[model samples]
Target: MNRVDLLTRSDALARPASIAVDDVSVTYPNGFTAVRDASFELGPGTICALVGVNGSGKSTIFKAIMGFVTPSAGQVRLCGLPVDKAVSQNIVAYVPQSEDVDWNFPVLVEDVVMMGRYGHMNLFRIPSRKDRRKVDEALERVNMSAYRTRQIGELSGGQKKRVFLARALAQEGRIILLDEPFTGIDVTTESAIIDLLRELRDAGHLILVSTHNLGSVPDFCDQVVLLNRTVLAAGPTATTFTQENLERTFGGVLRNFELSGHALHEDDDARSLNVITDDERPLVFYGVKKGKKKPARDKAK
Candidate 1:
């Protein structure tokens, strides 16, 4: 892994986690059940990889954790409280899949990151010195300080991903959730993100990231959760992410490399790729081009 010497949030590092999904089941409005009675415990200072095939409820679970979708059964808790409560406390940060973002909306890098501090501010209050400091620190952490003034629409796929990560950092959240963060990034950006995630983990943050890169689990994540509507297996990477569990989770479609421990091969199945490229999910051009304003509700999702 590449070395990433980045800014640290001591306050965020000192927090504890009670982020757990207890027998959670989510059924959409159309009577489609995405997740079924899934349960897992995520502790502080640990990076847990959420692995599954497409439409396997990974995103649904993330939404439940972020209080976007109310679970039909069971609940998601953070710091021993409900998700909304934890969010009100500004202790949770969520970075949605890049495919869900509308990048054409004109905005500066720093301005975009500053949106993370909205929960911390009172109504109509302007950004304070501390908020600016946090934004600066966050940009530096993601190695995007040089592009702080650049237009959000002018960034590469990898750079856009990094900007969103910087926003999460500026939030100073203890429990961070990322949905398919590596879907459309270059190798260098991927390495940098992995390094930054490790730095955050060592600094006492809890990270739950959904990814298709099984090879990276053993190397960076302390825990792995395999899901296919339910929790097939979840625990330490060494024990829970075995070939047997992967096959069970993927329904025997996962090909295992003999020499690569815990590394599942990506078969020709396009569904397994589950990749959304820039072309597939193009940015929408709307609204008057501007620098920044209070981000809209559900903007992160």
Candidate 2:
């Protein structure tokens, strides 16, 4: 990757200066409320992580922001323009989750990434030299240049994701929203993607990514938005990803295994080893499990 071109790209995104969501809400045809009065703001050069359990409205928020689902109430704005209008101008890019994409479709890696530039180029015009150059640059950014000619079905889960991300980067949007970008990928690929996101943020694009991984938030995100059908919390990771708040959002049943140091409900014994300092008291909660008792720790000790 050319450092000069990357810097130039970043500077261009920074000049734009804004994107925000105002009082957005969504309800399905069956009147099921997926997101209720959701609102947040993201400025240029920052990466925001949106987190929540399954069915917590994270995906719904992304759909609403992208204008795929019309809001039952409120608005989603990008640089003071409606999402649809901003999208038409190629101001934003969206990378949907890998599971959501159909791999059975016949498409090559380069062909998929090149689709990103479709909005900027004429609808019926074949890709020009400049468009192909942009596609190559995007592939290099994601470290997938060599796989340009490869079929999508032949790639691994991580490689397929990189291809989609390359497509988004090729679009050259000022703002990018990725839904669960890290799912099912190896640590190395995940790290590479995170590095790219940081580079993008430093370059001045606003990035919002929804993920289930809480351990990554502190290191990878500038801001964290926790949601469970609503905004449970939204702010810095230190403030929002707290034990108290997490328990409340995820339900008390979903205990933090880090504190207990024992995997939750792993043994049939229903008994877990506890270690506490002299001044500390260890609290153990037991629930009924249908099975035999395992040997105590002393047997192995």
Candidate 3:
């Protein structure tokens, strides 16, 4: 058996990136303004949620970062390098939304993952033993090793997402951009993805996930960028991802359901459990007494 060769993680994603989007704006040829005056900064070792609804300029922001579309104004920097330079260096990996992919296209799961390594390959784009090893390792990391031989279209929705995630991991880019990763997946699969993202964050990768899954934002994300046509708020999850900010960005009230602590058999601490949701699912949080000092910490804390 040939010994496996791999790109050392220290060399691939050696250090965290300081990502900054300062006063950016994107305008299409049709005189359409996707986003205007949007600004947000994210640190390394953090998972930032780009929160918005449909047509809220999430894709525009992503395109700007990847250098796919030049911003009409402002700058996007990755680790102090310009977007184009960063892209040329393969310092970023993007997992586009499922809707952008053709599931009917015939491709093996492993081959799909191998696409991630194309940037690192020579002009011929032939897979070396090291490239093959990276693909295998990435598949194994996403628990998709058993499906390596399966056709991409034959897998479940959640499995397809995992395969793409593995592709990004194989690329070993220091910065990852995920667009609606949890959209069609179940709670279990979503939770698993979040866990993996947390692991990546701890490993010094900077992750930007564009998601409207408000219920799960506080569960794992370290930072939040609230956007509509422009950035409404941006900062730590606990502070910036608040009810008021969400309402302001989404242009609606966050439906809430309250369950008394007594209902859960907590007589001493009879605080009511408030479930905040954007018609997704219940996001659990316990409210403090109006006169008290916010109870030191809550679930999201």
Candidate 4:
């Protein structure tokens, strides 16, 4: 048999990109501003974690980048082209929050993985043999090949997450946007996913994942973008994940228990602590508790 050499398909990867958000802002019909004047650029081969509170526009920004939500003012560009243009070329893949999905939709693992390839297939064309091969490769990469025939709803939470990640892999997207990919996953699966993410970064892929797990940012991400309806801090993890920045982004200490050991004093320092109103409960009770005064003239009776 004549030996045939197989070449890796790096050309299918997305072009080198500097994902730029030029003062982008998103506003809803009700006049609620989700993101305002947010500007940041993420380059190739790096992973960034978007951290913020519930209503802090993390998902809004992701939607803007994916063209689902249009920015009221600025622009979002990938590799020097508009986001929609980049998406049309199949250079972007988004893994939505698992909670947003209806797991009981009755879809098979491989079938869901195939959805990623639909972007590349012509409207009337069926999935080609190459598409099947890509699907197999993606499932294997996430170690979910054994469950390819299983129902997505039957799998564990981590397995479900892996399935979506496999879909992104099958797309061969250059820019991967993961929304809370690690939420509610097992420790083992979280580690596996983090390892896979690192490998992707090493392979020159750009990844931005929205996560509330602040501890893992330093270990698995190259950059951190702290958001509170806008870009509060964006840069290297070490410099950006400081206590002060986190407090500023998250609105003071994340836990009320951190306020322990501080007695309420009438000093200016105590007044500063009062600014943290979002704490679950008061750290220390202030003022004297009023009680019924006993009869002063009881001896007269």
Could you estimate the TM-score for every candidate? Answer: 0.81, 0.82, 0.87, 0.82
Worst 10 residues of 1 by lDDT: 292-301
- Identify the superior model by TM-score, candidate 2 or candidate 3: 3
Model 3 lDDT at residue 276:
62
Local accuracy of candidate 2 as per-residue lDDT tens digits, 1-301: 5834844654554446356767888999999999998888778788898977789999898888788899898888886788898889787888988888788788999999999989878869589887898898899888998998888988998898889889988888878898888878887888889999898888778889998665566667988788888888887665665545656676743434322224645545444443211121122222322223221111111
The local distance difference test score of model 2 is 0.75
Model 4: per-residue lDDT, tens digit, 1-301? 1001011264344368458999999999999999999999999889999988788999998998899999999999987889889899887888978888899988999999999999989997489998898888888889999999998899999999999999998887878999988778887998899998888887777899997766566678898899999999999875676556767887643642222123545443432121122332122222222222111111110
The TM-score of predicted model 4 comes to: 0.82
Clashes of 3: 0
| Model 3 per-residue lDDT at 235 | 93
lDDT of 3 by residue, 1-301 (tens): 2112233444454545778999999999899999999999987788999988789999899999999888899989987899999988788989988889999888999999999999999999999998898898889878999999999999988999999999998887889999999888876788788888887887678999998777778878889999898999999987777656766887655575656766755576756665666666546655663433121223342
lDDT of 3 at 181: 94
Per-residue alpha-carbon lDDT of candidate 1 for residues 141-161, written as tens digits (9 for 90 to 100): 899999999999899999999
Q: Which is the winner by lDDT between candidate 1 and candidate 3?
A: 3
Better of 1 and 2 by TM-score: 2
Evaluated with lDDT, which candidate comes out highest? 3
Model 3, stretches more than 4 Å misplaced? 1-8, 11-15, 253-274, 289-301
Pairs with backbone N, CA or C atoms under 3 Å apart (clashes), candidate 4: none
Computed on alpha carbons, the lDDT of every model, listed in order, comes to 0.77, 0.75, 0.82, 0.78
